[model samples]
Target: MATRRFPTREELRVWRDFIETGELVRSAMAARLQKDGLSPGDYTVLLALSEAPGERLRSSELATAVGWERSRLSHHLGRMEKRGLIRREECLTDNRGAEAVLAPAGRAIFQQVNRPHLRDIREIFVDALTPAQLEAAGEIMAALREHLTRE
Candidate 1:
């Protein structure tokens, strides 16, 4: 059998640091979002809806936009509907599909939460990096994304 190359010790250590730090930032951001009664999933869905043309997207499109599976989106949409944050309508173009529309409440609340979210991002991430480091981080992320796409 051919030997498979594992990450070298230094590479492994760097990978661990990257993963752990990313998790810490995500946790901190989630904590801040919880104050606005929004989970990351809620925020993600609202964000996608808010950006769509006419502030609405097909259920499948919304799922793709939020990078969630259909069932997960369906369940989260149910809770959000109960809270009056969003409303679902039968898709006008497709009888068998549905659409997710951003409700007035959802738009208002997303606007309210957006500023603080930006502040949290700056605090947890941008402020910690120097200009050069930030540029490097962007480049590194782009490289990784490109590599993934290739694979």
Candidate 2:
């Protein structure tokens, strides 16, 4: 008869801790966004476009910038457009492409949310870390992202 092997206690504890803490932080962040009236995804899109020189990016380029798939970004963009937060400008150079241009409403909402979001980020994730720790975290996160996408 083969013996069953179980995860060690530390392994189980680490996994559970990660899951629970991640969910708690996500919920808190979502609650914060319920103000400035943004969902997490909406906020992310606005921030991504805000950093662009023209406050606009091609839909496909934005999708890639955020590591979002085309269908997913399209669905979200549709919702944002309906909310008057963005406009899809038909690309003259590429008939098949369109730009996700941040609209006035989106910029307004982003401004409202930006400060609170920064506070929450510092409170929940950043404040505890030393500068060196933050640097290490950034490196680790980049490596993780690279590893996850390699396959």
Candidate 3:
């Protein structure tokens, strides 16, 4: 039987800090968004759609962009449609595919949420880091993302 090597104390400390910071940031952002009547998931979908050309994207493309599964995206889209925040349309390029478009209400809500959200992000995360630290964080995140995506 092979024995697994244990992580060193420094490795453990770094991993713990990384996970704790992520949780803290995520929770804080979720709270701020929820106060504005939006969930983190809703914000993610809206942001992705708002960034896409024509403020729309094919369902599969949206799922990829949001890092969500197809079924989860479909379910969320249905709820957003009911709330009149978004609408799904038949894709012109693919007969079997659909597109998710941000409705005016969704766009308005996102715009309304932006200022306060940005402030909260700055207060809770951004302002704590120097420019160099922010750059390093971005690079670290990119590397981590690439490693995870490779799996």
Per-residue lDDT of model 3, residues 8-106, tens digit only: 799899999999989988998999899988998999899999999999999999999998999999999999999988999999988999999999999
lDDT of 1 by residue, 45-83 (tens): 988998899999999999888888999999999999999
For model 2, residues 47-150, the per-residue Cα lDDT tens digits are: 99999879999999999999899999999999999999999999889999999999999999998889989999999889878999999989978987899999
Better of 2 and 3 by lDDT: 3
Q: Candidate 3, which ten residues in sequence have the lowest lDDT sum? A: 1-10
Clashes of each: 0, 0, 0
Candidate order, lDDT descending? 3, 1, 2
RMSD of 2: 3.5
My TM-score estimates for the predictions, one after another, are 0.89, 0.84, 0.85
Better of 2 and 3 by TM-score: 3
Clashing pairs in 1: none
Q: Cα-based RMSD of the predictions, in order?
A: 2.6, 3.5, 3.0
All candidates' lDDT scores? 0.93, 0.92, 0.93
Local error of candidate 3 at 137, Å?
Answer: 1.4
Instruction: Supply the global lDDT for candidate 1.
Output: 0.93
Q: What TM-score would candidate 1 get against the native?
A: 0.89
- The alpha-carbon deviation from the true structure for residue 70 of candidate 2, after best TM-score superposition, in angstroms, is 0.8
